[model samples]
Target: MRNFKKYWSFVLLFFSAFSVFSQDVQFTQFYANPLYLSPSFTGGIVGYRVAANYRNQWTFVPGTFNTFSVSWDHNSPAFRSGFGVMAMRDQAGDGNLANTRMGVLYSYDIEPFPDWHLRPGLAFFLQQISIDFSKLIFSDQLTSTPMPPTSVTQPGKDAVWDIDVSSSILAYSDNMWLGVTWDHMLKPVATFYDDNSRLPHKITVHGGYRYITKGFLLSRIEESFTVAFNYRVQDIYRQLDLGLYFYSQPISFGVWWRGLPKNSVGRRVDALAFMVGYKWEQVSMGYSYDFTISRLGLASGGSHEISMIYEFRLTPKKRWKAIPCPTF
Candidate 1:
């Protein structure tokens, strides 16, 4: 049994290495992490906005994936510009492999026609990846009961740093919006060893529409239904999220389907996510859960995510056009 457990540990470590460097952390609640989604959303608001998000994936696993992000952004109505700062951290596996990112972004808004606007954005990030070599178990060490140090050469560096860049453009009106983002334009080198391994570029295209309905009893009260989709591709991996949302005052509900229904590469359905949110005054908070449906099944223990947003204005407030997108 001990030998069997050690073998699985080696298997887990091998897979974790690939996942850490090959894939980017994804949040089920895309809008909740606007700055992370697209730099064009940097200042997509009239006033100051702050957001925080957390996600835990595959809880049943020993070394689960945990990610966290925080961002702040605000728009300048006079200059028709937006600026923001963001940071994120993602960690996985018992080896304590981690990635940290910090960045600043800018966006400028242009009006092409009446009630329609376009935003172009750019961001620069500093990325760092680290791992604890001491925690790793080698194949030679597993051959004996009292594991002896194997003749393995260390990478010489505990962490690696790189500069990354991303750009995006958004076009929107009062009730509809569309955006596209190109990430990792720099193809930053991501390796702890002497060899060069570049992080692949990712492309994301997202859009949404909202339909507003008036309340029967109160004419002033408005309820809205939104349909949104986010499609992303990185390397050979493709992920699509289709979601429906309903918002009535302080309450919001959402349901999302991830992955493709019919694909030539076998069963593509990954998970179904459900979300609930609440807003009071200037603060909005949300929680979501992903139900794993793939071959991993329920044993993966699913994923959980939480997000919060606060919007506020400074003195001498000025009216600015709001981007028509889902708030959660």
Candidate 2:
């Protein structure tokens, strides 16, 4: 057990050298947290919404990764606008390296044709990255009993703050939708040290199509199948998630394969995710498990995620065209 702790500590210390090349926290149930997925998805529904998400990655490993997020959004049909606010925090490893962000976003809805809608969105965020040097074990300290403090020089400040911007556009009809997002548009500086290391811009292309096999009494979606894909590129890293969803009334199930199959040079295959969800009246909830297939293998205990959303109307009698995206 002591050797295990020492092993992870050393691994964390090694990765800390490349801290500037950070990646965003990921969730298997992308649409479950609409605002996080894309600002254009803000207020995509007929009413206001509140959502929360939590993810724990590599549970078998000590202090591997934990992330949490919450968001609120409102759709104003009269104004053809969507407004939202979101907050997220991610913590990694025993060193307590963490990132936090709070942001506000807005989207304008335009109806170009009878059943087609286009939306453009913008978001602004305040981001902070911090690390606790006290928790980290240095190489010299690991070799002895009653380990002495690390000889490494702590940074003058423990945290760095920056401002960031993101933009997105989405187009949708009654059964299909496509969207694109560019994040870190301002190329925010993210390093704790004086060296100018800016957060790299990330591009995402995401879309899906829904096939309704059966309808409810009110002509709403009942039994259906959805096919979706999300592709993302940041710096030199690339990932793709292709998934299928099946829904029948209150129950939904999804299966996803994450990673590029063609890339054999590195860890091309990440995980296979399985998800289950339930919707009751105004509330919806989802849970997913990632079966790690990378070199980390099953010993990593994969990952677990849970999400919840509640929707309500600010006014009693307002209607809007719903974006044709999967709810979970």
Candidate 3:
């Protein structure tokens, strides 16, 4: 009975998450996971940049979801373009429902004016998703001791693999920027079931404006503040995120609100997030935590994310100028 109870409990939580989140994995620190947000960010770094990120969600739930990603990109002055590659994985539930992906990215930088520029990017990726059937016990997975003999367990195959493409474009200046991305260009049909269930294409639009104050923090460096907004839609779900950030040389602080106001209940408010970061020469690190505000409340265990990035030059190659963009 104890085993049965535990099994059912996990099944409930797992399906609940599946219904709410569906296929795509989301990041609270969107800026930290640049490549995941859009391919245009590929090679946005000056010379060469490498970055890694990790996220743990719903701390209170046993076997909750976790995601990790790594990427490397470089700017090419000769080609007037940039390229990169990225890998990511996500796992959830006691059944270990897993998704893994590898992708290649490319972007072209166009200067329309002295301080204004446009970057259009493209990405191609291959993905695989699978769930451990043995770890899951459906309503049919019960004892024969009683009238409910239909509860006997059975196993089934639930795996999918596919290739997808995405594209993005950005317009930026010294103090403001805007961009849009469209993912899952083919609308890949992937599901555990025998029939095809098309994964909805995802679209994200974002923009921000920054203001710098002379000598506000350090005599040699300036203090700056930025207001950012992001809106994303995938299938039937949509989210809007707004953030305010302050930066001074090597350090940054930010607060954000993530929500879907149209939804009823606590799920609509989602979370309020806080972040802090530091940069020293070639390396930078950032951390963030979300405070749950919706119905899930503290039971959601909130969310935590951390990231590290390094920028370097392999040799004294001619450096390609990069467009100024948000650092979130």
Candidate 4:
């Protein structure tokens, strides 16, 4: 029992201390998790919007990996701006390595060209991270076979805090949108140790286009086909997601491919995700199941994700012209 714990715990710490660990958690339904995708999406809605997301990954792995995020954004018609707040938490490994973040965003609306709308945004965030050193068993701690005679002092601190900056821009037209985001501008130190290792910079480029037809065979039903993709890079790690969605009235379905790597060590074709969504009035919800295509295989129990969103108006105010974008 002691041998099992020691070997596994050290493995967890070793990988986490290196750059192999992703500093930020990922979501399968990128369109559903708007704020986490880009700061410019903060208030980029017809009205006030609230969204929540949850993901569970690698059930077959020794430890658990879970991530959750919630955010709120309000598009002020009078100011023609977007304001939002987001909070997220990710916990992984048996030692319970965890990262939690909170952020506030503000975006201003601009029109660089005639029919295109540009939204530029800025965000300030604080992060807190922790790892359980008591669970880790080092070489010095193991004198003989079973364990050490005396208790080993904890290796790392209980928790560490840091502040960071991020920015994003969204450019959109009637049926198309393009967005880019940059994170970890300050490259804050992430480890519990006294060393100088810092967080790597991350950039994401995402866009989508929708082809709409007013009515289907049924007069009340509307039909549309949409294609979207996201390309993200953090240090040497890169990921790509391409998806196609078909919308018929209140229901929508989509398929996405995650990974599509760039010859990187840790980045490989990871999963294929199937998603379904429904919307009624101001409320919407989405669910996705990821089929692991990586070396982990189906033994990982794949992954599951769900998102909920609500958009509404608080008071009757003069509305600004809205840019057309996908609801999910």
Candidate 5:
């Protein structure tokens, strides 16, 4: 048992050191949200939209992390294309990182029948990642006995460039829709160590279906049910998440279960997420909390997420009926 503890401790130290150079950010509960990480999700809505999100993780753990992001997306009716931009900043312990991305999406609509429309889109993205290494605290064990205390002065900073190409196919009717998207095609590296120790890229595939059932036992209370699932695969690990959402016109609630990766040796971990949101006119607010089912449950408190979204429609006035919208 002593040897086992030492082995695991070494493993954690190695991963923690490597994490200083990795560009990939970790999230606790992913299925409750989608647009937080993927730039290709731009122009998915009907009109011009803006979204902002903030997350606080592991409240029980000392020196936990916080992440904040803001994004704007707009689609052109005349050009049948869309554009979006997003920026994010993450801070954990003493290390701070920032990312900015710009995306352009071109979509083509296919009319397979009278009532159904299929839209396939291709998007190009450019991202810049910057790291501030001065804040990081290296392990004291790395130093010799009677070593002097370390100071934050004379820290290192590094930056990297990454490009991503993604594609999505969306099938929609009046009440039902399905979509599939692929991200992180370039597999850009952002390690502080040797260039060969590259971070692995991830691929995710997801789809969801919604069903509306009206008036069984309660009057004026209608139920909208949805089932969503996603699979994420990478070189180090993979995860599968499935959940159900029950919603009315003004409020929504959801519960999810996440399956552990096959190679994970730790106690199986699951998440119970509860989400509530309200829609008012063209604006919406959402909040979710997740509780873990692993041994760390006592040590790592919980995760919290909050988001705000707004949408605006741009349409031609009656007097502009004769004028055609400009194309880009």
Candidate 6:
């Protein structure tokens, strides 16, 4: 009876929420890659910047499940505004399901105080989702007991259209910054298989502060540190993350901890994240690893991510204020 109940629960969850329609890409280090989450983060750095990131997840499980993204952001110093373009592709489960998204963003900055400025931004997005019904394998018991021939064939590829809006308020000095953003203003249906079932939109709020301490331990070495956190809430899940970063001139390092909701097995799972990176001139390269601590750990080897970013000063003729190095 206990086994039957567990199986029933799994079936209900799978049909209701565990399917591909509700699955979203998970990021262990969102602060290091802000553009992946919010379009308002475009041009939050300085000058013209280009970034690329690749993520490999659930290595412990078989088959390929990975995601890749690329984005470019540029700010006009003369106009004090910015624009960006981004694209992403995700594939999972033997290519039975895939998702692709493209976005364009524009932002305008307002100077409220002598040293502080607020930026309001907007982004328009296009999303495409595809599912392969032919590749899906149903349980033998259900397939063998089919009542009608027409019921054997399932719905084929589903293409969906959706829109999202976001805004952010940023305040900064020479060395520190604080910002907040709300994403996915317009929730859209992802599952064309059933009109009654829809994926819930997600909301995230985050902020960070950085401090540069000179001559901390010795004259030659300087320490730069940052503390950051974010809270994300959705219909069925909520996550909280806290992280700290430390860096010297050439090499940077950081660690983070993420808390997850209790699972059906009554286990509280968490993840340990570590990052390392190097910066040279106007280019930076970084990588991060996440180790899961839960019953699913045996099935998921871990997760790996790599990112690269480049920034170029667009206004060569005008003398501009120095912009701090971007952490995201």
Highest lDDT against the true fold, candidate: 1
Q: Cα miss at 36, model 3 (Å)?
A: 1.0
What lDDT does candidate 1 reach at residue 5?
Answer: 61
Candidate number with the higher lDDT (3 or 6): 3
Over the stretch 131-207, how does candidate 5's per-residue lDDT look in tens digits? 56555444443456765444223225466667867666766554455566665666655444444655466666666
- Writing each residue's lDDT as its tens digit, candidate 3 over 1-328 gives 7567557755664564355336488887787778888888888776899999999988898878899999999987677788999999988878788778899999988989977778999999998877776676455435444534334333365677889899999888777889999999987655565555666888999888878775521223356788988888887788889999887778989999998858523356788999998876778789999999978889989899998989995543643445444454
Q: Candidate 5 — what's its lDDT?
A: 0.58
Best-to-worst order by TM-score is 2, 1, 4, 3, 6, 5
Candidate 6 clashes between residue pairs 3 or more apart in a chain or in different chains: 60-301
The residue-by-residue lDDT of candidate 1 on 1-328, one tens digit each, is 5566656655655566766878799899989999999999998876899999999999998889999999999988778899999999999887789999999999999999988899999999999999998987766677787888754566789898999999999999878999999999998877776766788999999999988885532222357889999998888778899999998887899999998635424368999999999987779899999999999989999999999999995543544567877755
Residue pairs of candidate 4 with colliding backbone atoms = none
Inter-residue clash pairs, candidate 1: none
Is candidate 4 or 6 superior in TM-score? 4
Give candidate 4 regions above 4 Å deviation.
Answer: 1-12, 19-23, 136-153, 215-221, 266-268, 314-323
- Per-residue lDDT tens digits for candidate 6, residues 151-186, read 233445356666655566555555555566665556
For all candidates in order, the CA lDDT equals: 0.87, 0.85, 0.78, 0.80, 0.58, 0.66
Candidate 2 lDDT (Cα, 0 to 1) = 0.85
Residue 16 lDDT in candidate 2: 71
Clashes of each: 0, 0, 4, 0, 0, 1
Number of residue pairs clashing in candidate 4, backbone atoms closer than 3 angstroms, sequence gap of 3 or more or interchain: 0
After the best TM-score superposition of candidate 2, give how far the Cα of residue 310 lies from its true spot, in angstroms.
0.3
